[model samples]
Target: MVKPVIAERGGAAAGDDARNGERAASVRWALAGLSLCVLLPSLGISVANVALPTLADAFGAPFQDVQWIVLSYLLAITSLIVGAGRLGDLAGRRRLLLGGIALFTLASALCGAAPTLWLLVAARAAQGVGAAVMMALAMALVAGTVPASRVGGAMGLLGTMSAVGTALGPSLGGGLIAGFGWRAIFLAGLPLGLLAFALARRHLPADRREDRDGTTGGTADGTARGRAGFDGLGTLLLALTLAAYALAMTMGRGAFGPLTLALLLAAACGAGLFLRVEANAASPLIRPAMLRDPALGRGLAANALVSTVMMATLVVGPFHLSHALGLDTGPAGLALSAGPLAAALAGVPAGRLTDRFGARRMTVAGLAGMAAGTVLLSGLPAALGAALGVAGYLAPLVVVTIGYALFQTANNTAVMTGVRPDQRGLTSGLLNLARNLGLVTGASAMGAVFAAAAGDVATAGAEAVASGTRATFAVAAGLIAAALAVTVAGRRARPGQTADGA
Candidate 1:
């Protein structure tokens, strides 16, 4: 009788362990779906970059107008991301994610079918609003769903997906544009978005808001609490500030006229008003206390700076490849794909390293690598005409991408871990906001430099293109060096602490 009882107990233990394994597998699948959602929008951004020249030709638009194709999307995301995150916290991340996917799908369809350049830009802006919602909630959802011990790994995996998406974009987009047309890039998002929406709805849990009392704001049966009030005034002011600033930057290098002056003034006034409104609002869009946190603020600044360098390189590299090197659309796209491919390969390993070592060390190392890579790229034009020219050009991109992977994985982990559980959504929003803002600012700044150097891309000769490319890289290197300095300073400001200073 004793022997029989012991065998039964062992069988019961085995059964329980099997069930746990099954549950873990389910969670992993859900996380994978979430990563897919992240991947789609990221891919869209890079793919659109490669398609810019094609779009300009198709619509007979100038380079300045063509740029708005990219800028409009980023601008919309920057303006609305914080508000989206706040809504996710008040409503539900799963719900908002589903909504975002739907809207993104609709916008993608519209973008593909747009008959005019302005209409296409409008559609891209709408797409940005949808992308912002997804970006704001993605990290927060991951943090909420996964165990704290595994957060770094999960973040890494998500980052990997993002890198892969970006890596694939240029190559895939080039092939599609070469084979079909530029419209194919926009149309590609439709199926991906729809599938992601369906899978997310089925697999992702319906998370409720966490209350101030450390309990979930839900009924006993698990229904969500009432939604919080919206901050319309705060949202409007923030949007206006960002729009004005981005407009100023976009037009700064052009003419330097009255409109630019007015935009700068509007941006200044709007920024001041935004701060005042946020400070006094009952339910602030961004918490003043959170901004005061040294780690968060510095992390955000570093994120923006890094993004600026990365986007500047991406925007400038394709033109250089096509115009200066006389490469076709396909080859140029393939060349541009190198960096993101390196980033994809490095992302997971970097994440694991961050988990094992610490975010601070990895972040510093990453920034240093970025600075070195940018400096090397600045001389690529001179180097490329040598025996090992291609290698010289490609090697620096690999280093830069690897650094980006390490920095992003470690820094994101730091930012997420530094904030309170309830604040994750807002923090995620801010993170994305910084990134998108960087993209817009970098694109504008670098495009201006290229224009000033090259005279006109459509009409410029090879030598002019080369000159512009070299100059842009030089400026980019300076930006990265400055970022490295900031990172070093931030580290010194908080000794014996990790990237999050936790």
Candidate 2:
């Protein structure tokens, strides 16, 4: 949610003043278009996971190559989001969104028709670029179109869509694959893209025009506008650091050997370089001033931790049910839905709670819930009855997910509220970057922890799976506990003390 520069009077009211009915209707349709475009790429991220086995068999690529199809999309989306958002500010968000939809739709077609594995991979990367554009532009469009008072509600909807799309991606893809084969999964985005494209063309408002006539409410022409640069050095360094580090983590301890060691070295060097460059640049990719705010710091960290727990549950929980408990895929999949469903159910109430109590209290409570849930999840053993086992697993997952949703909603609101209006686009980019990084970091780290535990276990059957599951949940609990501690300490040091002191 971008804070409007016109804070004394919100843009939505101004938009209403600009013209009551037609302009307001335009905003609604524009928001709907942006929302739909945002949904497709997020759906793509997880949808492919369900189709990977089918893809590998069809293309005869190595399993590792198949993994790149997922990794590349994550890498591109995570790395390019900030740049894309900046591009939207420099160019126009509406133009960028339309172009992105076109490109994305075309890329989906390419993916669906690829004759070989490499072509499909290339097409997926192209799709990632489009995804980045859509995601980066969507929020900015909302900020630009929606009135300030309604920004909260609008952003809440965006957040819900992102969360819901992520959870639904696998199930939706699974259904597509089951009914129509792997290609259908890729093609699924086509209709969505087309719909968004048509709606945006029909209803999205034009960019603010610069008039030369100097009429009643006009500004002079030839006013010098500062040129925005891409921070090429910072961008290069950040890309190297994030891509290399993320890949190294995902590759586990020794998968890449000497190359991994080299990548790690490069990542470290890149980080130092990025910091120095950003500090000196006229228009930096990330502003150093923004990091000084306690609100931004806490919000970013809390969301990262929340993301960590959220992804960890999704990555590890199902295996615990299916592999360790000998449940079939159908039942295991059903169990996995508990968390996301709980998250969806909890979002609205959580928002009102945040509005009433401020973010700090809600964030702390959420972490506490996650911690308790993780601890309980870690203690589950093999002797329980089916109903008890289901209850034990589902209950903790629901609690943690609900906590995560609340934490995310409150944290985002707090962060956006803390920043200056003009800086909202940059702030949104950074927050999202934190989230993607956290998603990759948590999943990789937790998977490594689980694998390490399983490696040390002496038993070769159900006992080993049990030990691994227990160990994973134990580590997850510790992570959530650490997250809780961070939240507590951060809240205490917040710059502005409200009634809730959040």
Q: What is the lDDT for 288 in model 2?
A: 77
Residue-level lDDT tens digits of model 2 in 1-502? 3455566468668777878788788888877787787678878887998889999999888899998888787777787777776655555566777888898999999999988888888899889888878877676566567775465456556666776777788899999888999999998888999998998888876654221111133112443324455566777677778887777766654344787778778778888888998887865677676676766776777677667767778767766776666679888988887777787667667767776677667778778888888887788765552347667678877887887777776666666655544455556667787888788777777777776766643344555666776788788887778777776777653455563434
The lDDT for every candidate, in the order shown, is 0.80, 0.73
Q: How far is 328's C-alpha from truth in model 2 (Å)?
A: 1.3
Q: Model 1's lDDT to the true fold?
A: 0.80
Report the error of model 1 at residue 247, Å: 2.9
lDDT of 1 by residue, 473-494 (tens): 7888887787777777777434
- TM of each candidate vs. truth: 0.85, 0.84
The local lDDT score (0 to 100) that residue 253 gets in candidate 2 is 43
